[model samples]
Target: MKPSTPTRLFLLWMLTAPGCGLLLGLDDFEDAGKSTDTVSDTDGRCHIDEDCPSGLHGQAVCDDGTCEYTCAPGFADCSDSPGCETAITEDPEHCGSCRSPCAAHCVDGVCNAPVDIATSASSASACALMEAGDVWCWGLLPNAEGGSRTVPLPERIELPLPALQVAVGGTVFTGPHGLRAHFCALLADGTVRCWGTNQLGQLGLGDTGPHEGAQIPNVNGIREIAAGTDNTCAINAQNQLYCWGPRSTGLIEGDTTPAAPTLIAESVDQVSVASFHACAVMVDRTLKCWGLDFYGSLGLGAGGPTHATTPTSVGHGSNFAEVSCGLTHTCARSSSGVSCWGNNANGQLGLGSRTNYNSPQSLNLFASQTLRAGASHTAAVIAGDVYLWGSNAFKQMGSNDAFDTLLPVRLSLPSVSRLALGERFSCALTAEGRVLCWGANDHAQLGDGTLVSRATAAPVRWR
Candidate 1:
């Protein structure tokens, strides 16, 4: 979605956007009422998109200090009563507004993702996120809004559905490995009913067993679940971590194999684990990680032929605000700046050269706030512009050289609000709430429909 010219502004228009906001300066909002230092509720005038800033997307024409989200054709307010939606939903051009629409239901005036929602009948493939206080999912355990709304005994798909995905299309969570797929979880309830590839006891059926259908009768206590190349990690309500699968590094750290949800970390926030390693942030925002460190994917200062058997600190970086783990490397944001360490074979470290580092190295960015690490590549945006480097074999770096970079390489994308990096691909949620993706498309990871890869940035179609 291109930036529409702003039309109005209102000071009394109050809205809150979580973790994402675009503060349009004088030049960006480009409306007629941009004064030097006067912005009162009575100063009604439109100038640009940010004029009547609230959770609404697009530029609003401010009339009497109120901004009306472009109420054009196909753009209708899908906000349920009492549901505080940041943007509009049901727009053919922009569904669910602000990046992704609600996960599934408008129940209770909130968007719920694909999970074991109460309003649902069975497990599904995906569910929309709702601001309301309920949940929903898609697939075929029964049918919430499909064939029927009532199913005797509440039957669901078989367990152990493979290939689970969260934060999909519109923040909906996807479960059920291959078959119709049965799963559970939503605001009211969340149980670990997973499917697919149960080798090495990942299904947590009390054995290194595999189930084609939902495993474990209920998984309500699960608070966080992360899927990796092969292994999976889940943190239960008690702040414990659990893992199952091949190539185990004892991440669960207990006498019993974490074939079930195990406890790990310092009871703070559990960071997402990647293919070979896992890390998390503590109550005070400190970082603790474990698992394989093949090429320094551990992010610990001293990198070598050593790996942590349990969660440990990284290179004296206690204040590590945020961290992202990739296939063989890790990048994190610290008080000072962004730093990376580990395998440089594909330049995933983003240290400027294809040289591997056994220690954390800082990048020479003008001013950086965050970083995201991919399989063997890394992407970061300092200020508002984006930069990527490392592992261009699949052209995930958005450069023509196909050579690994030791420094931060720039990707000329406009301002972005949120960023999510996949195994070998990267995605950015723009300030306009539209998703723009570039880089590798091997598995349609770029979501641009084609097996070809991109050497530069491009807009991905969500339609």
Candidate 2:
């Protein structure tokens, strides 16, 4: 139900009220799909430096939402505080506060970014990548936020104390030093901590809290972490994978969130979490998944007679280097090329059709090493060229076509060096040191300049 005019006015009036309660209401009222928010933020509105919080040091905020900052090119805190500025420039410690301002991209006092890979459990909680392998998180972390869009990037979280590590067996600890009691760092010590919303036991902490940031309990020796839709998967130094959330239908992304990450029942060198599923590459390059396949995201079967609760092979293929999953579809790549399947309502399957597919469809487009799946679209990078397919209702496909693409369309972005896929938007890193994004500008995730959706792509100067 839409709020009435008087209700909107009431909301605005309460915006100035007391307590963090207002903040909560603001967060709740802001419409869910938004990946970015700029309401009462000091830098919320701006022009030049003086109009900004820190006074003089940021981008202009035209009718559209764009704020330049003093951080490095690809990073901005957007704090805009009186003395500090916005998070784009918030961390005096990193940029203005700390020494590694641009590098750390701190928000508040902790290094962080607001973009989270939303899904079931990891949603409400902030996914934190700690320094020296100590990961921690804070905020409305839900133990059941599920759906994909959980922790997309590592951010610094406000820590009243050092991060506490939760064990696979449900043992909890406080402080980084204590985590070492039964755990060993792995994967160059890349720390990925998850809290808030853990129904499937995705936190691996003996099950507790559906929307609270309680550290998982038991077990030890950990490193990297990835949250699927309803599961949580982690890795140790030996490249071993351990998942526990929604094991049935690959929803085992830890607690109960699908795609959070659960033991796929396979040992692999790598893994990738998708909307309601997850994929992994064995040492020999074999691909496997353990989650929902109603849309054929799990491969093996067309999904439908029903969903599976355990890991399944993705067709006997090899040299499969990478794989990605979306809401109703799945796509992966091998030495031969890319193959995808599942729901094509918006062409998310990338198989060149809007028709639902229960069978595998070869992209037969350009070849690439990286593959990404969006809620209803698919993207892949072949060398430096980016190609996309599927639904374009919100331009999530990155092209100017308002309809779905039966085949892949090569997107030439000379300014782009890297590519990332969001739920409804696609972004890339430019060779000229800039950020280019397009599609579903609704939540301002496009970071372009306006709320208007785009059929083509646009450049976003994050700095």
Candidate 3:
């Protein structure tokens, strides 16, 4: 569905009010001067929900072939009251019930943590780092299916230690025998833990046995971690890089099996893992990439190796703050502008053409604040506005269509603070601490409690 522009106050209400659902066409509430007990369409004319008036006291729907008002989701009529009169879930005066008070903050109809949430996504699942220092996951199960394949909603996960951040990898061919997908957690104590799909040694578990559950590796002093389609990498406090997983084409070099974390480079500031390669930003602000460059993803000059098993310098320009790797391309934010290279068949390069480039190309159009690359698309934040380009087969570009763009298209969303891109979906964390997503929802990865795809940004239901 096309998500409408929401006012600040309405967004606040949605975030704090449990079961509010996504109320549409209710922005002009001035006409609703006084609350009404019930609302009915006297003019017997309506085929869809939108045909009803906007100011109706509750959810407006076609009931019994007539327009009527009902309580929104997560809201209900008081036992003593019926019809349109309602009790909200998070309201302190009606906390989960009529006339109840909350001792703390109300969340999902209950008083709980007041912290802003951080969200992460794997290919088929997404996880949230809650304010209470707990991680909750929702969406499709990695290798398991049916009753065991989906969580459907956010469910708390038991971790041995408090997780500061979490990263999830894709599910396709990620396990020891290519049988499972995985996710990794960076704990508050600077330690690293990983689980699932150890077949390729992505878990760095030393052995591939016990492919399920979490594994706490002795590796310590880690500061940042990133997971890829099948492998994982981390940068320690010392700025050294360590990686583990199956050896595809020397992305990690000589590793043939599930191996312990191996140091790859030093003085690394940030690291990003893609489907078949990885890129890093060094303390000197230079970019380096390794692994398969079948489509010139490494961004090395034409004279450079087709594929570098070891890290190779990208372009001469230093001043890079961060870098992100996609399925077959790489994007980095430099002091000058956003630089992208590699696959352009889907216009992911945002270079205004489908032609690929072997060297870094600057997008001199806008001042990029942040950048994220998906399987066949790229999203960058320019002055708080997100611009998306490349594949939109599932409306991942928030245009509500399947057309591809050779140039960047601004997403109609509020100022974005961060972005996470899945294989065929995209999510943005708003400045207000709310999560919004669009694109494919085959596995409920969009996290709106539905399996329907959205062409525009829609709030992810945390409640």
Candidate 4:
């Protein structure tokens, strides 16, 4: 039977209704299927939070028809990959954050941990040899204003090559011009580089003009280096020693002109210099000294010549391991123990008396691993313990007493591996790579983030 017109229209509408697949035109059905496929494909792309994949070390979220990734802390997506591939905490090129580079190794997201320290005897500056062969310095350092200023925190000093050792010297000029300090570093390429004041050609750059940055000295093949008041000295791999700068200390014979590096001695194992005197330990384990013999600093016995232009033997007949020269005194470590001589006005000799000794006086201490002498103080490390004596004017001995100590006193501290002394301050490096300082902070040589002096040991601030 044929359907009515009105009934035909109603049947067409019902065929097109949702979930009703009754008879319909082929083109219309094909269009409806295409629309359904488009919706299904869009939903398959990302409809729920779980539909997105998390990137490596990152979190992903489906938002606004797109997937966004968020990197975790200490990680960054520095590449085209879908993961955070860079770990900034351990990366030297991106230490603590992206694009921040470290001159040396990175530690716990921090850069430039110190491995060795150098302090000046007449100036308030100190330098550290970083683990990565870079150098960092603080205290009274040269500023960009063509003068010197105090730096409470460490700042990396630019160098042409990686450093193996560092030394500082020069006296704080009492005049209006600020400090007259200088710095030198033994580069990894067996050359020596220096900077700062060159009033006396201390930088070894041939001229006395002030230098702003690192400059190569007329010296090379250096294994060890030491800086003194207006002078510098170094020992080569061939056991030869060379010195330059002002001839006040007689480091070089002839006129009083500032000289380039000149051979001073041979068969030298180690060398140390001070304001007016210098000393060296020969390969035979004997000690020798030269320069101004103020208060018998030369250790040539009483009534000797006031000064010896050439190296003179310090006869004690003991096998010396190390020797250090102070402003007016000297101390040495040997198989027998530690001994000191020269000026003792402040008991810097570590003896039980204030009387000066024209010869080496035994400290009666045993198994001393290291010893160091400052302007008017002395320090020694025995069995991993630090002992100090002499001047307390700036609390250099780590004591609150106003009087100087006449004997060595142990400091309450962790196991110390090394020590560095300034004009009126001291620092010790712990076996765990930490640094502690005490005494004067007039120019922030203590590096504790303050300008106030301390009578006890304090940890150095890394920031």
Candidate 5:
């Protein structure tokens, strides 16, 4: 039954109170699909504020027995939807009025110069490469908050010079090593610098002095950089591979000289590293991999050596465009399609099965522009559509489901230009220059300013 006028007002006030519990039944709320404009107490519309869902537009309320979204004082709703989806105070599309687009861009809802954003992720933290090569980092860090370990928002990080690329990862170690995460930046001048935990020399600074950041001596003209648990590798302009940090032999990188960068290979075009292995794209478009292969992550075939101390060709093709390494698997893209090999536990291989493959198994997905691998998940950008497979324990799949998928599933997002996968989270850069992240946010890695893990894409809020 509809409540009386006085009773409706009281219910609305109670619903808007801070920390007040909702005692209303489900039937009291109106459906989102129902428009509020026609709502009337006698017309079987909404009779009270509780009759409408809160947060429908911003925070909803009942006015004169009619349900509508309530904006803060001086705030105006500009979106043409049933409720106010955008606040005129800061909405770029409705800066001051409905359908009024921002002149330059929108920031915090206000029109300003549109910002360009590029993102990178480590196991627990994330970094954004912004305009003019400035970098901002957030999430969990070793020295954050008296060592309490979580930075909930983005903070500009000072580097010796503007960085072109950044890589972050947590190295797995035992006893005194445990897990130490580190960061590395590739400078515009073609040099590489590193910071954070140096327990295993992941920083590549000659000495393990736990410093803010330091440039690696003698190594210059670097074109690309990739990091794993306790090691860092880079491809020089001359197409040579240089590596530092602790040894994880058979990954084509081991400690022949513990204090300096060691030359691993030459004529390499690109490289990627994860837990205990690494892969590289050769000049001929062929792929090679090394390191622990107990899970067939090397894609060297079941007859190949269990561990390859040197680079071994992956599969029998030279048509690969890129390759990525995960915790216990490897994936690559070719003119034909995407394929993965190694441990399929949790379906990280994305072959529609939990069974591991010793040889390259075609995923039959679309041709990919780029791809990335996480601890137990894989993501790819195929003609702008983002597809994820394998583990969704933390919703890294971005499918809004916690259950794992053995096959590729397209994410509900705009065309993506690039992708990055973390231990239990995923992030992407849309063609529109926006950064969106999802999955685990216990350490605020998703950058929504909340530690809440998201099952769907959330814009990376920048203050």
Candidate 6:
């Protein structure tokens, strides 16, 4: 029953008076339409989802009057913070996603990948072409001052277009005149770009100014390129060979200056240039060589001729697959096996002896997929294994023992797809696209972020 207004007022006043024991109940206020449930008040933390701040990993949201977060792909909120904080793109411990570990390197959400690698035979520098069409280099790199300097870690090289192949060439002399180095990159458009020391017009820019991104003039449709101590060569899609630079050892004939490309030979499949000589494998699988034959490097038989001004046939067969020219030696792979000629002062021929061979001398090993001849060393990949010989004074053989060997010695490594050799160092490209290097690191040629030389293979540090 409802009480009179005066009686209700007296009851409320008695409950509110001092020393009153009864507590005020909401039952009397129900008729005023008041809510019984608790309502939340956000004390300026956030009013809407857009009011919350986003962190490195991306977006945030407001829910139940509180700010919550969401992570973008390749990121995660692995910590107790209110923002997404972890990046899984390059973290080996959590590559691509949380708890997805990688064996060696993590790059752009993938693991252990590189496409091609090139090392200078004269200086301690190297470059690698990544699968993403970017180029990274280390060791003695070219500086903007038209000179070169040593770098202990990998640095990205800017290019106007994607690169298909990269080649490094240089020459080291005694005394104050130290190193003359250069680099060339073949773009997807069949144009060539070069930079570095251009004292002899090796950069192919029509002038010797140590330029960068200098394109070879009047040349297009080139399929391959090779650089030597002070010269460069290219082979167009039509199998025509062209060469430029100082006219030495018959590399260039007549009054053609070193500043312009000149036609050298035709139907050439592959060509390799060195300090004073050059060699090529014709389309018919026949090997031809010209230039100064130091210690019979031309493979024209002992006591034959000291120099050949024109392309002359070498060996006795047409099964030649490829050839590599070194400082004073040459090595070639034919259908039979691997054969080497010329300088063997350090047993670079892998012939199990210190005696130099004027003609082709076959090694006991079988066919090789890739072969390289350095200043005084040689490296070959046979059945996925690396075989190295010649000078070990710099521990380029991937062994701690600094002793020269005349026979080929196997390196402790995984399946190798390709190999590149420097004067005192070596690098190999693994089947998994990972790059491993050893030997001289005086200029950080190994790309391991240190100047200390290594006797065994170590993974390159990208960062």
Candidate lDDT (C-alpha), each = 0.49, 0.49, 0.70, 0.77, 0.71, 0.76
| Model 6 clashing residue pairs (backbone) | none
* Location of the lowest summed lDDT over 10 successive residues in candidate 6: 26-35
Per-candidate TM-scores read 0.59, 0.57, 0.74, 0.78, 0.74, 0.80
Model 3 RMSD, rounded to 1 decimal: 12.7
Q: What C-alpha lDDT, on a 0 to 100 scale, does residue 158 get in candidate 4?
A: 94
lDDT per residue for candidate 2 within 284-337, as digits (tens), equals: 888777656665666766433344555566675688877766666778788788
> Which lDDT value does model 5 have at 108?
47
Candidate 5 global lDDT: 0.71
Per-residue lDDT of model 3, residues 1-463, tens digit only: 6444233333454456433332332321111112223222243444555543323345565455555555555454443222334435565445565555443345566644312332222366667665556776666545432112555556666788888878777553344344245778888899887765555556677665545555656578889888887688888889999887777636776646655778889999999998778899999999999988868989987888977888889875899988988888888998888889998999999988999998899885557888898888888888889988899998888886678988888888988877888778888777655667788887787778888888878876656
User: Which stretches of candidate 5 lie above 4 Å from their native place?
Assistant: 1-122, 144-148, 171-176, 249-259
* Candidate 1 global TM-score: 0.59
| Candidate with maximal TM-score | 6
For each of the candidates, give the backbone clash count. Answer: 61, 117, 7, 0, 6, 0
Mind giving the per-residue lDDT tens digits that candidate 1 earns over 171-231?
Answer: 0123333222223322234555554434344445545444543434434566766555445
* Residue 316's lDDT in candidate 4: 88
Please identify which of the two predictions, 2 or 5, would achieve the higher TM-score against the true structure.
5
Off by over 4 Å in 2: 1-191, 196-204, 208-224, 246-263, 301-305, 415-417, 431-433, 447-452, 455-463
**Per-residue lDDT tens digits of candidate 5, residues 1-463?**
8987756755665566432332222211121222344232345566556555444324566677667665443244432333433345555556555565653334444444213332222377777676456677777665731122567877667897888888776633345665456778888999987777776566676665667767888889999988876677899989999887767445534454344687888889999887678889999899998888868988898699888877888876778889888878888898888889988989988877899988888888766899888878998988899988999898888766678899888888998887878878898887766778889988788887899998889777766
Higher-ranked by TM-score: 5 or 6: 6
Error of 1 at 75 (Å): 10
Report the Cα lDDT for candidate 3: 0.70
Tens digit of lDDT per residue, candidate 4, span 225-331? 99887788999999999988877566677686777888899999999999888999999999999888888888999867788888889888859999988888999
Model 6 residue runs over 4 Å out of place are 1-72, 76-86, 92-112, 175-177
lDDT of 6 at 331: 91
